[model samples]
Target chain A: MAPVVERAREVRYATAAELPEAIVGADVLFAYDFFSSAIPDAWPAADALEWIHVASTGVDAILSPELRASDVVLTNSRGVFDEAIAEYVLGQVLSFAKDLPRSWELQQARRWVHRESERVAGTSALVIGTGQIGRAIARLLRAAGIRVSGSGRRARTDDPDFGTVTAQEDLHEALAGADWVVCIAPLTEATRGMLDGAAFRAMADHARLINVGRGESVVTDDLVTALREGAIAGAALDVLDTEPLPDDHPLWDLPDVRITPHNSGDFVGWRDALVRVFTDNFARWVDEEPLRDVVDTSLGYVPTDGSAR
Target chain B: MAPVVERAREVRYATAAELPEAIVGADVLFAYDFFSSAIPDAWPAADALEWIHVASTGVDAILSPELRASDVVLTNSRGVFDEAIAEYVLGQVLSFAKDLPRSWELQQARRWVHRESERVAGTSALVIGTGQIGRAIARLLRAAGIRVSGSGRRARTDDPDFGTVTAQEDLHEALAGADWVVCIAPLTEATRGMLDGAAFRAMADHARLINVGRGESVVTDDLVTALREGAIAGAALDVLDTEPLPDDHPLWDLPDVRITPHNSGDFVGWRDALVRVFTDNFARWVDEEPLRDVVDTSLGYVPTDGSAR
Candidate 1:
């Protein structure tokens, strides 16, 4: 925000209610966190709004019907979270493979338990998305010697990162052999509640699921049931259907579930990075040149051209 | 053992006390665990012993005075543990970098705490050994985007893994900027008790120490004091001064210290791999071919020619 205040031609700071008045003449809208029900009510006032930029990769929260129907350009901070989210996924994978939680449990009890651990080198992972974040996760996992396959909306036979990118329709087949299933796909009408009870049942009994995507991508109740019934070994979810999960949420107390507030891709100075991404895009917006990370508002994400598959 | 029993001209099985009688007519000795206090007493009876092989990497446990002075060849299972130990070290480093323990604590209390995590890339590590295990650790860490400097018995300027390997004498200088200090050097008179109070003091307050080398390489009491006083952030010790880590040891209860019972390198099927390493050498021995992983007994381990540096 400081960077933008100093660099932008004009910066107007206003609350949700004040946004309707403020949007009357603004050309660019930088929706930081975009958490306002007032956004739609204020949408009629954005008469001169030429572009809308979100500080987050997920634009669903800010994608009002009016805005979606408008000719205004939509862009997001896509590449910014790539490496951080990749590292988080890798960290969780290694934690599960090395059994770090068990080690801690033994440490607390003053026990010296020596158990043979699984090797990550020859293990396999089925990454559920072929976006930048998922690609980054695949790259890092491969770098550590894991066998990685990716799944996208469509099947790809020529992917260099993942030799054959599995189609979303064939995800269950991939899940059966995967030691890890990482979800980093974007949230959209098509993807919401995609990982349901059937998906969980398809996964190997020893396989672990990691959700760093959106909470709605998984059916929370089904996940709880899967973990309780041991249909899958465990899960590490950074995102949940509800933010600040309710005190009585069964997922919170499950021994096999590791819950982290949706901060997987966040590192120190992330806000600064987010601002930098927008500022760079803003410079392009001012120049009327093509912007980076422009999203297809209808798809609710920056559609991959199957290049990174 | 199954492979050896099938291939050997004669396979003799005996307890430590019975070893003296069994070893009299044996040409090769496969010391499985080699736990006998009677090995030195039985040395005189091994008139026909031409070679000795141990199932474990560290030969210090089986390197008896009489055996070292004898003409018998000695070898160890070196390459077997390289990848496993490297993965263990990387897992621990990621655990610390991601603050997984804090996340777990927050989860246990059903708190959705969001905290910024540190990035592993662009961080520095000072690996305190240049041997196979140390090099493996450095390689894995570097793969994960860390700037790694290695330390060995002597300074190496031509090492490819590390630009300029620091000598053991200058470890303190390396420790100053390191986020991770991994000790995987062999247990030798010079390396024993190398990481003392002064060494801990030289590290950054947030840096962690990972010891997968040998327990005696660190002064247990100094490590306890350092961890207790927060001189160092934490430690993941696979090796401690005591095996099975006496239930009453303070290290067991230290919040920051993660203790694994010296099994960091013990992966499933490790025994089979160890035997394969020995059996491959045995085949070479039977054919009058030179053996692999031959140890220079006078130096107490495989003498590196600075080739791996």
Candidate 2:
């Protein structure tokens, strides 16, 4: 409701390393802080700039004091990676259901093994943090005939997006009922280490946990223990507390755990998608139209804010 | 028009190996002699058998001269595995599209490699053999926003089941336009080697082939050649010319090939589904009603005679 708008006069590109230099003289500044070798020394003035867009969805690192204090509009590429990440989640689920890895091993040994697999239908999914990724995950799960729920900062009884909505304090109740627990919660102060030993213990033994969000939201040691003790059936992680987990990392040796580098939403055309979203926001800024997917910085994300857009 | 209706008589359980012993002593015997550990040597007499329901949709082995001489009702498990097979096909398509195998490799190395992936939403699929499996394939494809067509031995333009029902000779046209070619044809003498070098050449360079019906319906050597030469993009095979493709088989080494041990329609509770179908048929037989999915000795399978129920 604070209505922080941008009035563009001149543009600056403060990306870490070399970039396409296409927006040299435009009245907009585009930055790729995530891929840069070093941070830019100088910051753009807020009053002189009308729009500021980050290439990555998570703006925690790039949210400098000047960018925050300035009244210019701030938007991140939120919806660009939704479909790709959703597809990745579906692929991992199917790969597990179909026992593809075991089949690959059997093929290598020329052993004609016949293993039965479970279906995705009639399952229940609890998606923590009802953000873009969470919504996409819910849509795909629903399409697969699974009932889905959501857990957020506040409880909402009338929200039709989730069959069950539980407040953050009641996360355990939601975890206990979920057949598939998907962690897409932002790594905010309130949600950090949210899924720990207690939450894992509350999960159904047959449930599968998938994390495509921040790794800090889950306690890695507790997840490993849950998997080892069969507290939960299986898990697929695309993000870890530490990027490029060491080869000797104990997490790699877990039997029912799937570990991937944090590339779930990073597709080949992803850069272009980010640019497209930013360009659309840029066009909207010049027209004095309200921007989409603005970060709260205080609440970690803009609240459903009545519109649910 | 041939009503092969037999009298109340004995039933032999030749396919007892594939099915459970509980299915024996049935008024209508299901002779599933497919890859069984030899025939049930202590089987009941043929004279007492009122009907011989084959577990497999194809009855090539059971359609012998002696069995044909009898008036026993010969039904097949035609519709039992359609949905399961369709799910398997969808799994393969998604796996290929999302680059699951490559992701699996990168996960092992703890490397974050992002790549572009194709979506199946707007592709065209050509399903050969417009039977239960073919119809199921079309339905799933339609759900995924894909256009689908089917070709059969007999052409029927008025049939809504297939977008383009063409004769066997017109298969080239079907293959030429298809982005995916699914072969579920019966393994009659005519269908054997139907997908040979010429057929592969006719397919689009980006098309993929999936075979779930019968192994003998495709030419293994020609298929290997097509994949190796990039005549067609890739293939996911459930059934093959050999049950367990020998360690030395060349098809196993093909880069674009995915080989499974003929378990496309196999999943958890699949046995229950087969039993359920058989139980329904058994009830109909007890009521002296016409059976469904009766095998047309000439065409392999068709609906039961119009007047028999």
Candidate 3:
């Protein structure tokens, strides 16, 4: 569908400091940092607010309850971060299989230690949330000869690359055979504690976990307990419920855990990607085409929204 | 032509030390540790010595000059180590791109850091040799969306997966566009010191080098100079001119360089892989089919001997 074209007036900028005049009369709302205390709680229902675009994939913070409840079309920068985070996941999987960290320590000691490594081929991977990021990972892993299974809130029989896909209720069955379990689900109320002790126990003994999604989805205490007891192989985490993880957190000392400070999808060109995503969304909204990455306020997810189809 | 096989009426054990008289007349030979004193300098010219196979890919030390010049056909275990070493290369590539070593150090200090990382997609890789291991690396890199090129003694046009394959003479040209330069070529008289300052200078500034083939193939001093000057982004080395890279070596202090003690392919199942290859070759010999991986006595590389084909 061709987008509805709204006439352009002067481009209004919300500089995050001084509010650029009331955008009620403007045709577009470029909300970069409005969620961070810069935006007024309420505004007049104006022409400027016809299309609201967020810089982040998750619109929970940016969308005031009323904004989401309103008719203003909302879109997000969702696809921008997939390649970066998927690459991060692949890197973590390789590091774990090849024992690169241990090799580095041995190198430091000038020792010729030989360690056996597992091949990714013939291994099974369980990907939670068959979103853009998860789909991209499935394609890449499938190319490498891995068997990938995807899990989301509902079964997706259309995604053929993932051999066995199921809804949230079947997560346990999915994890039973996976050698690598990737968590990329957003933090919805239902998913907040989805990966708790029970989930951990379902994973294979040699399974490795990677979280580039919402940290709250995984119960940190359960993860630590699993790692300490050797219930699972290891983990590589780029997200946490708390930013700047506390220095005294026991997770820091977990023997097989790898931690990154919430930077999985951030890269050199990420800002440019973010800008591109927003610019395209703006164009789509201006032309009145169904907006891409439209969030389902009720479900709290950027819906499939027919964009993928 | 099938491999020549003979029956053993009597067998002798050199490493086992207890030679049985019942095996003295054995026509077939299985010499393990037979060279504890000295490798037999003279070819025995035993009528039963129709086939000789070495467990190692490199038979330089195993084959005495006489054995190499002998009339008996011989083969070496060439395919055994390829997969294991290719797995190692994948590890190094992932580690470098993910900033894994730095992350590990930070984790140890309980410091949370978020660093920019690289994606493997759309990058160019240069494999210096187009042998079993190099081909394996190419397959993995291709699966990861990297443009792969290779250099071999002879360039064949049929291998279209290689973006820009070339003959050995064009290696410098191949290195120019490479984001990753992997060396897995055999160590031959002509290949020794092949990777020097001049070669490193030709590589892109952000490119990484991984040497898993042979230590003698790289000039350590030149490599160190190139790395120190930032001629290339970094290096992940599994082999060095000297094994167990001396404690005081300057390369150890370079933060950008990752060192391993020549242990790229020594995995748990390596011995079994060698035995399997050997057994297959023996079976082939018994069938009077052409032997595989026969070395050219004159060139020290398999297949340089035109008679093998």
Candidate 4:
């Protein structure tokens, strides 16, 4: 940001509350606190704003109807979180399959009980998102020998990463055959509350859910019921509807549930990486060249047809 | 074993104490608690023994001077545990990279502290063995986007799975470059106590050691010293110098040590898979065809040239 600071006529850094005034005459805005919901309120003040670049892969947080209807172009840090989140998701899957949490507890007690672990090779995984992060996870999991399928907004027969793309509409039918269902969809009307009790009920008794997507995508209470009733085996949630997930939340102590702080994609040096993405895009903006990761705000995501990679 | 019962004149199961008498008239033996040391004691009674099949990858427990000198053929369940151990190793690597154990502790206390994690992709791994299981691990890690190299009995500039395999004697030099050191080598005179004090000292302070191979390959005291002095980052040991490690062993309370009872290769249905290998070999033996995974007695492993998959 320092290198590009001199290029702007005036540069302003502001908190969510100060965004309205800060965005008044700004031609470009960098949403550093990407999850901040002040964008809608500040939208009326973005008088000369032509572009808004976010330091996150998901644009749902700032994608308001007014901005989508306007001429302001939106871009995101799309490719940045792909590998990091993919690695995180794979770690969770392996942790569950290998019974690592139990081993940690047993190690604490100095217990040497040898348990038989499941092999990841032949097991199947159903990735709910077909976006870059989801594709990265599918590739990584496939490399680990897990058969990977996908459930996206639309069904496709020939996806390079996910061999069979099941339509999100038929998610329950797809869940029945999967050993693990990974939800990595963005937050949208259709995606929110997608993994409700009924979806969990459709999963196999041994299937586990791994959610690294938006917290709002899953119905928290319904998920709690699913885990309690044994409708599904367990879950590894990196995001929650309410976070730092209320210290006294039921999910905190669920038997087999794994709760990781929403830092899956925040790998070491990620801040620098995010800045690099913004600066690179800023350089393109100054040069009047094509920008990268432009979001299709109407869809509340960077559509696959766009230059997503 | 029951299916192959009719083909043999007699099928006998023997404990270490009763093995001497049990081997009196046996033509073939299936060494089932593969780590059993009773074979040498029962050797003299195995007058008619033509072959010995082990239910394990490592034949160290059954390999004896007499058995090597004798005409008896030695075969093992080699391919059975390759994928299983590879997945376990991958899991351990991910577990370490993602700081999952700490997350488990925090989750226990309902604490949400977001920490940056390392990326597994693009990081390098030094796989210390070019055998079947080691090869499997190399392939899986490579699939996860990790750069893989190997250390074997001999060095090679160009190899299939491991591009540049360092000689076992130059292991210290190789230790400096890898983010992860995966030990999956078979135990032999050269391998025993291989990872000693000097070797640990040569490794980068940030490097981690994962041992799925024989425990004797690593000197316990030296590894303890290495961890204590920060000679190396940490270790995840699936095998230990002592089985059912003493309740008060130093490793139990070591900050970064992960101790799992030697079950890295034992996945669900693994016992059945090992049996299938033996039964298939038995059927071949009855038909007078070449057996699979025949251990090269002089080399103490199924030589790479000996039809090893």
Candidate 5:
């Protein structure tokens, strides 16, 4: 970013308010803050805007009818978060399977209690997205000997990463059979609030949910009701609908829920890695070469050929 | 055991005290409580004993000079614990690399702080045993892309699971290069109190130790001091120098130390699995077939050809 700022002939910086004026004649708009949702507000002033490069995965925040209809090619930082997020999801899975939370409590009480733990090798997991991040999660969990399938936009079989890809419409059927459910779908028209009461009821009572995707993908109220009613055994959420979840939030004191701030894909050097992705994509745009991680505005994600890697 | 007991003409069950009299007319002895030291004391009365089977791994507790010098064949439940223990160790490794303990602390207080986690894929681990359980750990960690090596009784290259197995004498040199040092070695004359002050000092300050081996494998005081001075970053002990560690013990509340009762290899059906192991070996012994999991008493564990599977 320092090098790009130094080398450019003209560079304009703006907050959400100033973005309208600052974007007046810009050929390239770099949405450094991907979550700000400022791009659409300034879309009318982007007279020369040829492209918009977001610094994070999930371009839902910036996507709108005007931008999607316009010819502004959009690219996202995809690869940077794959491995880190995959590791996080696997860690959360193991935490529940091994009863690590109870162990922590016992350790605090100086209690030496022995309990039998469970194994993931023979368990089944259903990943709710088929994008890069979801594929990464599938690969990692499969590596641990867990059976992995996907609930994607369409149903298919013999996928490279997820052997069986069930269409989103069949999510309930898939949920009923899985021991673990992971949500990594983007916040989109059909995806938002997908995990409601019905979905929870569809899951086995011993099943657990791990959400590293958008918080809105799950219905918060339904999740609370499900937890209270013992619809699911536990949940480990990295993303929550109401983040920094209010201190009085009941999920905080729930019997078997684990919460962490939304930093799942963030590992040391991630910022540099994201910058490198942006710079590399920028160079490709400048050279008129094919860009990587190009998001199809209509599809809302970078489509894959049924292969995880 | 029920089926066997129902058919036998002279079925005998005994407490440790009665074990001496029980041994007077026994042809085969099954040491159900593996940790009991009654075998050596009962050895003098074992006039007809031909085989002894222990319902656990780690024959160290029951191994005695008299029994070793006797003609009685020693067999242990070895294969039962491999995969279960491997899963536990990997879960523990992820727990550390992902900062789960601190996440638990933050979650309890309803804090939403974001912090970067670490990946084990590119890091290195040194497993301090080359037996079945240790090799299982090596295979699992290596699958996650960690560079896995071994420290055993001998130094060799091209070993199946661990590419290069360092000799036990060079443990200090090996410890210096490892980010995670896992001890799964059995307690033997050479291994007892092996991880002392010099060993901890030899490890990098950022390195962490995980002991799933034996309580006596590490010197507790030295480990406490090492953790205090940051000689090593942290530790996760499934087996400590003292079981049910004393309430006032300083190690209990140490900043980064996590303690769990010694149940790393025990899973939901582990007791049944152990019984199956013993029963299967008994059937083989009665038929005069070569015993399975035969402990080379002098070597102190079941020797492997180095293949993890």
Candidate 6:
């Protein structure tokens, strides 16, 4: 915000109840933490709103019916998360394969337990969603010698990064033989609650699931049941249906589950990088030029056309 | 042992005290935990020992003065541990970079802290030892997009795995800017206690050290002091000078040190793989053919000549 203030633009910062008055004369709105519904509640006062930029990849929270019906240009920060999230996925995968959690447990007990671990090389990974984040995960995992397969909304056979991407309908078959099932798909009607009890049953008994995408994409109750029943080996979740995971959440107490505070894509200097992306896009917006990372509002994300504009 | 018993050969299993009588007419001796020094004590009674195979990569335990003076061939299970140990190194590297240890600590406290992590890609790693195990670590770390440099007994510029292998004389120079210092060198008189207090002080403040090769290669007292004073960030030690690390050891109580019971090279099926190496060599011995993984006993490990044999 200080950097934006230095740009000689009048910026109005307001609370949820004060947003309506602040948005009355604003031509552009920067929705930081767009997951909050305060922006939509103040939508009627956005009379001069020409563009709305979200500081996140997922726009499900800010996608109001009125905004979708309006002519306001919607944009998101897309490429900012690729490498960071990919590193998180690899970290969790290696942790499970090497049993680092158990190693820590033994360390705390002062027990010098010698246990044989599993190797990551030659193991199979089924990465759901072939977007920039998913492709990044596949690339890094492949480098570590994991046999990577991807699944997207439509089957893609020509992707060099994710070999022979299976169609979304065939996800179950892909799940059967995979040693890891990583979900990085965007949240949408088609993807919500996609990983239910049946999906868990389709996965190998020794397979582990990693969710770095939206929490709504997985059925939390079903995951708990699967973990309790020993249907899958374990799960490492960076996102959940509820933020902070609620202090009383059963997921926190589960021995087979590892919870991270929805921070998979965060790295040092992330805020500066996010600000840079927005400021660069803001420059183009002010000059009446086509903006970069323009989200396709109909699809709720930027289309994979390999374009920055 | 079951496979050897089923080979239709006369086999006598005995304790270290009884090994002399058992070795009277034995053509082959399988020293499965030869570190006990009992084999050397019973060496006088081995009248017909032609070959001895140690079920581990390190030949230090069985490198007795009498054995070195004798004509008996010595071999070790080399290739079996290369991949498993490499995986272990990578797991620790990723764990440190991603702050998984801190994440686990937060989980235990039920604290949902969102801390930014460091990126592994584009980071620098200095891997000591250019043998098969070191090469394997370099290969995997390189695959994960780390800038990997290696050190060996003598500098070699033609190596493909590590760009330019640094000589042992310049190891401290190699440690100056490295984000990770991985010691996978064999245990030899020249390499023992190579990583001392001075070496730790030369490392970057945020650098982490991983020792999977041998405990004696690093000075444990110096490492503990370094960790206490924050000379280096942390360390993950799979090999310690003492096996089972004694319950009262100070290393066990250090928060910055991660201790595993010298099991970095251990993986599921490792024992079976060791037996396979021995049984395969046994067939060669029976046919009067050269054995595989013949250790250059003078050097304490197999000399890397780019050959599987």
lDDT by residue for model 2 (B82-145), tens: 7667777777777777777666666666566656776665788888888777777767766555
> Model 3 Cα RMSD, Å?
4.9
What's the lDDT of the predicted structure labeled candidate 6? 0.86
RMSD of each: 2.5, 5.9, 4.9, 1.6, 1.8, 2.0
lDDT of 1 by residue, A194-215 (tens): 8999999999999999999989
Name the Cα RMSD for model 6: 2.0
What DockQ does each candidate score versus the true complex, computed on alpha carbons? 0.75, 0.38, 0.57, 0.86, 0.78, 0.76
Q: Estimate each model's TM-score.
A: 0.94, 0.84, 0.87, 0.97, 0.96, 0.96
lDDT of 1 by residue, B224-269 (tens): 9999999999999999888889988888878778888888888889
A110: Cα error in model 2, Å: 2.6
Query: Candidate 2: lDDT over CA atoms?
Result: 0.71
Per-residue accuracy of model 6 over A53-96 as CA lDDT, tens digit each: 88888887887889889999998888888888998999899899
Winner by TM-score between candidate 4 and candidate 3? 4
* Arranged by DockQ, best first: 4, 5, 6, 1, 3, 2
lDDT of 3 by residue, A1-309 (tens): 112223343564455544545665765666663353354443443445666667766665555666667777667788877777777887888788777788777766766775676666688899998877787778877876778889987787776656567999988888888999999887788788898899999998889999988789999999999998888989998888776889999888787788998877777777777777776676666566777787777776676522331
**Candidate 6 Cα deviation (angstroms), residue B297:** 1.1
Local distance difference test values of all predictions, in order? 0.85, 0.71, 0.73, 0.89, 0.86, 0.86
Kindly give the stretch of ten consecutive residues in candidate 1 chain B with the minimal lDDT sum.
Answer: B32-41
Fraction of native contacts under 8 Å reproduced by each candidate: 0.77, 0.33, 0.65, 0.85, 0.70, 0.74
Q: Name the regions of candidate 2 deviating beyond 4 angstroms.
A: A1-27, A36-50, A64-70, A156-161, A302-309, B1-27, B33-45, B65-70, B153-168, B303-309
- Winner by TM-score between candidate 5 and candidate 2: 5
Candidate topping DockQ: 4
Model 2: reference contacts kept, as a fraction: 0.33
lDDT of 2 at B274: 65
In model 3, which regions exceed 4 Å deviation?
A: A1-28, A31-48, A156-158, A305-309, B1-50, B60-64, B160-163, B286-289, B304-309
Put down candidate 4 lDDT per residue, B25-49, tens digits, no spaces.
7898888754457899888889999
User: Any runs in candidate 5 off by more than 4 Å, and if so which?
Assistant: A2-5, A306-309, B33-35, B307-309
Where does the lowest 10-residue lDDT sum fall in candidate 5 chain A? Answer: A1-10
